[model samples]
Target chain A: MIELEGLTKHFGAKVAVDHLSFTVRPGVVTGFLGPNGAGKSTTMRMMLDLDNPTSGTVRIDGRHYRDLAEPLKYIGALLEASKAMHGGRSAYNNLLCLAQSNRIPASRVREVLDLVGLTAVARKKSKGFSLGMNQRLGIASALLGDPEILMFDEPVNGLDPEGIHWIRNLMKQLAAEGRTIFVSSHLMSEMALTADHLIVIGQGKLLADTSMADFIQENSRSYVRMRSPQRERVLDVLRAEGLAAVEAGSGVLEIDGATAEQIGELAARHQITLHELSAQRASLEEAFMQMTAASVEYHAHAAGEHKVPAKAPPGAPGAPGAPDQPGQPGQPAVQWGRSYEERRRRRSSRKGA
Target chain B: MASVPAVLQSEWTKVRTVSSTVWTLVSALVVTVAMSAGISALMKATFDELSELEQATFDPTFVSFSGMILGQLAMVVFGVLVVGTEYSSGMIRTSLAAVPQRATFLFSKMAVATALALAVGMVTSFLAFFAGQALLGEHRTTLGADNVLRAVIGGGLYMGLIALFSMGVATMLRSSILSLGILVPFFFLVSQILISVPKAKTVAQYFPDQAGSKIMQVVPDALGSDVAPYGPWGGLGIMCAWVAAALLGGYLVLKKRDA
Candidate 1:
């Protein structure tokens, strides 16, 4: 278990991390989510005591990191990739020095190398390894001591799909063994697949700390869209039942805050012939954007300004700020970091206009 | 607190595994021995051209280590790389994490690198002395002579101190390129050139290399150089002060700054 009590760090006058207080409990993988420059790396560094905290303290398994007899055995952290190893030395020898420092057995070096599938290149210089290979080596070094708490910062940055799948499974497997796993990334989609719990930060402030299921249920929106031959009768029935239904185009009535089962049963009682009663649920990606859009630190306003087109429907499917939308001037991912509250105000003004 | 011996063992492994350690230390020995032998042979052949002052205070013991002016640069490289590579390769974070006690990590690394340098420096000093003496022929001074053994041992101490001073500076600067950029030029050009200037010589005499070189001289004002206010051991003591200050500065920076 890692406990951070009011941890804060300041770089010059800028507050990089503001009073971040949370505990990463054992037996589950806790995903740390934030946009770029949101103090994830700084927080991790302080936890390891690599960078002294400007205020507060971090306790690893109820002891300060430095106070632990052998820190590597307690917590193994892979900060940044490739750059941490000695490029001049072979992979095996590079890990050997760290193992020897804490009096770990040399045999464990080979075991970790094999664990990361780098046994064949164990003697090869680390300078020659690819980015994917470098990440694997970093993981191997972190596992060298058989540490109880494992932390990885942006573990899948430059990996292939196969490597990404491998790491996701590895974290799950490690957490299954009752190890505390803390991983950080900007993508919620990745975390959705891997993280059991999430601790989110935005602009150096804690936004939410909750279970994955709760985070999704609270932040994500779901509504039922109904397509009926007699759309007016369906709307009349919904209005009589105190359910507000809007006429979506093409003879469809959309009801907010109602499940498909409830709408279907109501239409059946009303003798309304319904062609479609499908539920539209927001993706975890969209939910994450809504929660964190206001507190994003670095905003990339491509081409001088982002022109939110007037009279356009806001929050529509496939709108800007949606992920996996390629070939934009800048990545639309930045749009996801915009202030959701401010966007709503602009949207209301557009309606007035 | 970490066990000192275990940390020392880890540091020793770090120093020995790199190829730079072998190249730099070997060159410190080979270059000094070869260059000193050549210079001593030339001095012996040109004995007739020497002035009365030059012949009167030849000090073959001092002449034997002449190549140190060039050779100590290799020692500086050795020392700089020992500490500087940790920062350059970004391994300092990993290293400090393993042994979180700042003093233990820094001192253990230095202790390992310094011990290796002292050993190599001793071997280099002995070989340079013997090779230079062999070429000097009749002009050669024996180790049995008064002050000769002290000068030879001091020669070894001088090289080790040079490397130690470089390590301290490197740790303070925190980059191999930056330390080498400032250190190599200062030792190879600035310190050597200032020693030749009449007015600047006064301050140059107090420089680490200029004061430390006094340890290698067996005779007073050897080779017509001006007499220093301090004796040989006192001069070395001045150099030791510089090394100590640099190390203290390094430790403070390492302790206060983020990795």
Candidate 2:
């Protein structure tokens, strides 16, 4: 188990990591999510005691990293950069040196090389290896001691499709063995597929810590979208039923509080011809964007609509009362917890009408 | 805490696994021996053309070690590479992760490389002495003579110290290119050139190479060289002081800085 208590780091007046506290429990892969320039790398470095923490402490198996008899046997880390191996040395020898340092058996070197599928290139220097090969060699090194806690920072940056698939399964297999696996990535789609739990941060602050299913359910908007040929009649019926229905675009109406079954029965009772009635849940990417909209540091101005106005509170995930139109100044903050299917249903109902 | 012996073994593996270590050490030996023999032969051929003072104070013991002027550069390369490659290749982070105790890692690596350098330096010194003496013919000084054995053994220690000093500076600078950019010129050009300049000679004599080379001279101020204030042992002591200061600086840098 790795526990960080109020861990914080500052690089000369710029707060890189601010009081991040969390635990990575065993038997699950925890995906560490953040935007670019977030303090994921800094937090990992502090866990290994490579960078001294300014204010807090990191305990690995209840002991400080430096206090452990042999750190590699307790926690293994693969940093974002594939920089842990000597290019002048062969793949086999690079791991051999690490094994010897930790008093791990020399035989384990060959085992890990085979595990990473680098047995054929064991004698070749790493300088001649491609980025994928280098990443595999780094994984081989990380597994040299068979530590219980494993951390990887952007392990799939330059990997091919097959390599990506291999690593995803490898992480799952490792976590299944009751090892604590913590992996960080900026790609929400990748995290959604692999991670069972998520620990999210934005601008070096902990934003969310929850299970994957719960995080999506709470942060994302899911609602029923309905379309009818007689858009005016449907709107009148919805109003008479005391349901607040907003016209999306054309003849469709977006209702947030009612379920598809309730809306379907209501339209049938009123003799309205219903074209489509389905529920839509926002994608994980959209939920992540909404959550970190204010914390993104490097903003590309090309898409002006994506910009979250500077006045929005950084801690507020989604603030209401923001105008939804583009080209409008002082637009009230975006309303979270509302599904986008309403807008699409309005457009479809207009086409039908 | 990390096991010292384990780390030492690991450092040994790191050094021997690379081809550069073997090539650099072999070149240091071959170049020193071959070049000293060549210079010795040339001196013997021109023995009749020498001036009276030059001929009288020739110092045959020092002549056998003349190749060191060029050869020590190879030693410098070997030392810088042993420490610098860790940073250049980005292996230091991994190595430190295995052994988080900074002192254990740095000192163990230095111990292994320094021992190898000392062994190679001894072998190279003996070979250069024998070959250069054979070429010198009648001008050669026997090991049995006074101060000759000290000069011979001191030659080996000088080479090893040069390499160790380079390792310290490399650790402090943390880059092979940056360390070499400074050390190569300081040893090959700056130190040598300053020794001959009218006003610079006084301080230049106390430089690491100039002071250390005193151990190889059987006669004071041999071959019209500048006379130093200290004796042979004192000069070696001065060089050792420089090495100590460098190693201390390197240790502090490694301990204080992030990997």
Candidate 3:
């Protein structure tokens, strides 16, 4: 277990991590979420005693990381990639060096190489390996001592889909084995599937700490998408039926609160032929944006309207749906709790563009 | 203490695993031995022209120390590779992470480097001394007579000390390029150039390389009175002092500074 109490890190006048406190317990993958320059790396560095904390303490397994007899056996960390002295030495030799330091058995080098699927290339110099291959080697080095607490900063930064999937599963499996696996990443959708717990941060401050399921269920809302040959007819029926609905596209009306069953029966009774009907729960990414919209420090032009919806409180998971238009009937005037599904769809569509 | 042994093993791995380490050590041995033998042979062929006193003072031990001038360059390379590589590659964080006992780690590195240098120095010095003497035949100096062994052994000790000295500079500079910039001229060119200046010779002899090189002399030169504060042993002592100061400074920096 890693417990950080009132941890704060200040680089000269700039507070990189500001009075942040949280516990990364064993048996779960706690995703450390933040935007670029959000101090995620700084916090991780402090946790391992790499960077001194200006205020507060981070204890690993009840003792400071530096105070431990053998730190690698207690908490293994991968703060940077391809950091094991380059390709000058073979991959096996690199791990062997670390093994000697941590008093790990020499044979474990081969085990970790095999574990990360680098055994085939273990004899090769790391310099010749691709970025993804290097990342796996870094991971293998981290697992050298089989420590119970593992912290990885942006471990999936340069991985392919297959490698990313491998890491996500590895994290989950490690957590299942009762290791405290904390990983940081910018992609919220990936975090949704990989992280059991989320620690969202923005501008170097902790925004939220909650279970992923609860965060999604409580903070995210569900919405229904609808389309009809007679768009106007569907719009009138939705308004008369007191269903909050808005025109999403030329003939599509996005409906909320009413289920597909109710919408289908109502459209059928009105003799309106429905062309499309789909219900979407808020995605973790939208909930993240909704929670962090205002706190985002750097907004890329590509981030687009995906800015945290105006309604969701900073760190609050659920907010009401953001209006498709400036003013839609179902959409609340207050921009909060945008459904996660709508956020995902918006991001996906944006990407598709 | 066992932990210290483990640390030493780890540091050994660090040095040997890098091809640069192997290349630098090999280069040091090669350049130092080859140059010493070559210089000794050239000087020996002209031995008949030398005064008895000149010949008496010419300890073959001093001859063996020749490679050190060149070998020290390799020593500097080795020292810098061990410490500066971490800074250049940003691997110090990983190193410190694996061994959070910062001072122990540094000490272990120093111990490993010193031991390796001493062992290699002893072999190189003995061979250079023996080979140079063999080549001189009638003029050949033997370890059987005079203070020959002292100079020969001192050559090895001098090499070991200078290697540690380089390690100190590496710690202070923390960058291979900068350390090389500072070490090369001070040990190779600057001290010699400075001492050549009539009045400045007094101060130039106090340089680490000049002081350390005193170990090569069997007789104190007249220059010792005006240039060096002590005899050859004193010069080695001064160099050792510089190393101690550098190592202490490095330890403090490693202890207090963030990786």
Candidate 4:
């Protein structure tokens, strides 16, 4: 287990990490999520004692990192891809040096090499290895000590699909063995697939700490999207049934607080011919964007505006800085529902004008 | 805390596994011996044409080690690479994470590399002296002569110390290119040039190389060189002080800076 309390780091005048406190428990893969420059790397470095925190303490297995007798035997980290190996040295020798330092047996180096599937090229200098190969070598080095805690920063950044699948399974297997697996990535989709629990940060502040399922369920909107040839009758039936139905462009009526099954049965009893009926669940990516929109340091304004035309402006009700409770007043999903109605009214008024 | 022996063993592996260590140390030995032999041969042929002061002050012991000027540069390269490549290749983080004790990691690495350098330096000194003496023919001085063995051993010590000083500087600077940029010109050109200038010679004589080279001379003020206030061992002491200060600075930087 790893615990950080009141961790803070300042780089000159810029606050890189601001009082982050979280615990990564064993027996689960905890995903660290943040946008670029959200202090994820800085936090990881401080955990490893590579960067001195301005004011904080990190305890790995209940002891300070520097105080650990053999740190590698307790916690192993892959900070950046291919950066931890000597370019001029062969992969096997590079790991051997680390093993020797920690007094780990030499045989474990080959074991980790085989574990990462790099045994074939173990004799080759790492400088000549491809990015995928380099990442594998890094993972091999991290696994050299067979530590109980493993941390990886963007491990899947430059990997092929096969490599990605292999790492995903590797982490799951490691976690199944009751090791603490803490990983950081900006890819929400990847996190959704790999992370059992999530500790999210935004602008160096703790945004959310919950399980993967709970985080998505709480922070995102999932509603029943229904379309009927007689859209007016469908809307009337939904309203009569006390369902909060809103017109969601293109003759579709979106009803929250009701399942597709409930909505379909209601439409059938009213003799409304439904053209389409499906549940629209928010993806983890959308949930992540809503949570971190205001804290995104490098906001590509043009790209963001072009891609998400109806995205609410910063400081809008339910935007970042609001409470974390979903479906509450001023929550992202509620504000988005209100905005959709506003947009539809404006479009009809413009036509009249 | 990390075990010192383990750290030392790890550092030894790091140095030996790379090709740069082998190439640089070999070049230091080969260049020093070959150049020293060639110069000794040329000096022997022109001995009769030397002036009175030149003849009086011609120390065969010092002459035999003349190739050190070019050769020490290779030692500098060796030293810089030993510490600098850790930064260049981004392996310092991994190394530090494994050991965690900054003092242990830095000192252990320096100790292993310095031991290798001292070994190679002693062999190179002995070979250069024997080869240069062979080329000198009748002008050669035997190792059995008074002060000859001291000078020979001091020559080896000087070469080893040069490499150690370079390692300290490289660790402080943390980049091979930047350390070489400053150290190469300062050692190769600036130190040599300043030692010859009328007024600058006073201060330049105290420079690490100029002071350290005093140990290689069997005769005082050999070849009409400047008269230093300190004796040979005293001069080496001054160089040792420079190396110590550099290492202390390097330690401070490593302890305080973020990896």
Q: Please identify model 3 stretches exceeding 4 Å from their true place.
A: A225-278, A302-353, B46-60, B136-140, B222-227
lDDT of 2 by residue, B1-259 (tens): 7999999999999999999899989989998888999999999999889888888899888988989988899999999999999999989888888999988998899899989988998888888888888899899878898998899899999999999999999999999999999999999999999999978989998889999999999988888887789999999999999999999999999887777
Q: Relative to the true interface, what fraction of contacts does candidate 2 keep? A: 0.83
Where does model 4 sit among the CAPRI classes? medium
Q: Which ten residues in a row have the lowest lDDT in candidate 1 chain B?
A: B1-10
Model 1 segments more than 4 A misplaced: A224-255, A258-278, A302-334, A339-353
Against the true structure, what is model 2's DockQ? 0.73
Clashing pairs in 4: none
TM-score of each candidate?
A: 0.89, 0.87, 0.84, 0.89
Please give the lDDT score at residue B214 for candidate 4.
94
Return the interface RMSD of model 4.
0.8
Write the candidate numbers in order of decreasing DockQ: 1, 4, 2, 3
Candidate 4 lDDT by residue in tens digits, A109-201: 999999998999989999999999999998888888899999999999989989999999999999999999999998777887789999989
Per-residue CA lDDT of candidate 2, range A118-182, in tens?
99999999989999999999988888899999999888889998999999999999999999999
Model 2 segments more than 4 A misplaced: A224-255, A258-278, A303-353
Q: Which ten residues in a row have the lowest lDDT in candidate 1 chain A?
A: A305-314
Candidate 3 per-residue lDDT over residues A141-208, each given as its tens digit: 88998999998989988889899889989998999998999999876767877888999988788999
Give per-residue lDDT, candidate 3, residue A302: 27
